[model samples]
Target: MRKAAALGVAALALAAQCAAAAVPVQGYAIKATYPHDPQAFTQGLFFKDGFLWESTGQYGASSVRKVELATGKVLQKRALPEKVFGEGIAPHGDSIVGITWMNQAGFVMDQGSLSIKGTFNYMGEGWGLTSDGERLYMSDGTPEIRVLDPKSFGEQRRIKVTVDGQPLAKINELEWVEGQIYANVWQSDRIARIDPFSGRVLGWIDLSGLAATAKAGKDIDNVLNGIAYDAKTRRLFVTGKRWPKLFEIELRPAKK
Candidate 1:
């Protein structure tokens, strides 16, 4: 088993090396600014039907909410059980799927009513969750992104994330954008753009110092945790927990 895993990793590393030379991403300036709550601990962010939805973490504070983009007003919210630590979230049609930290439980909620519809079990603590219109992609604060059948929520395949032949660890929040998976490195400001086919890190979206503008307040969630992309409009939205504003920035290829 170890030998097979080693060989698989070696093959992926070689593929990353070949793709690294072609990866071109230049950072762009902030395009738009939106309202963000300074008291919400944003764990996951997604855009659906012109509304922005956020899932917050922490034990007692865990919640899923739908908010107006311009006003920062919560349209609907449902709290998690006191024992479950909420994590990432993704949208599926009219329903929302949420993962729980250390609980191994995932919930499917009514998209319009915001009520729990069903639940499933996972093997590891759920950290980040996203989908590719078909299968669900999840992270457990590890390098691998586990693909699961959306209906069953069971593991189908797994791919370890790497960039330029180096393993990228602590992959937290994930967003599937244009056939690629973008992930935030936990406790860090940068988000890596990964190749899902081979789990190679093509490049990184550096958010180092991006959170400097946010003033820390009492009981504020400090770590950056929100990421959402609008596919139809091609806009990327990002914000940290308890942040005062949501930034829509364009990605420009970093100069070598």
Candidate 2:
């Protein structure tokens, strides 16, 4: 009887340790605010060389815009062909690449001119994109992230994201921040911070009340999306679809 009791205690201790290994959910504190185009249905966002590059979706209104970080002024803009719905944008070498939803095509543009350089074809839907300077990380609205060669636009590898051993789906707009891949979960106020190599979710950033704080009466799609990190300034920014305000947020560890 004593041996059985000892074995049961060991089992309980092992279970407790396994439970402790689960990742924690976190929240954010707004450090600053910036004016964003209220009409912009942001699907992807990134910062480079002091400018904010944004991609907006919707069949006819899909566009890529380089905006002034502070004033929300569009410095340059290029509209995608009306038939394609824009999804994600990433800096590739001296150029930029933007992907389309459902079209399986991606556009390469000259960074300075924002003019289409060419289009490349891919297999699945493109939901989010980001570059780690060497390779492109892409999400297809599933739990998997594909690593592609920036030059050939060919898939090199894939990572299946999971939180505490459970698959995480609906991964949306992505930004590679401080060596971690940050992705917005579609239709949710949570953002998953994932390990690039292991695909294990390290933590979650919950911005639950953010959209409610938007300008009253402004029309919005009400989904939390879009993440951009300024490596030069080490600033993190987030905005939602059709949200008028952009926020720079600081992460806070959630309580146990």
RMSD of each: 6.4, 3.9
User: Residue 183 deviation, candidate 2, in Å?
Assistant: 0.2
What are the models' TM-scores? 0.87, 0.90
Task: Give stretches of model 2 more than 4 Å off.
Answer: 1-21, 216-220
* lDDT tens per residue, model 2, 67-163: 9999989999999889989999999888998898899999899999998999899998999999999999999999999999999999999999988
- After superposition, which runs of candidate 1 have C-alpha atoms over 4 Å from their true positions? 1-25, 216-221
Could you say which candidate leads in TM-score? 2
lDDT of each: 0.84, 0.90
**Top candidate when judged by lDDT against the true structure:** 2
Ten consecutive residues with minimal summed lDDT in candidate 1? 212-221
Tell how far residue 39 is off in model 2, in angstroms.
Answer: 0.8
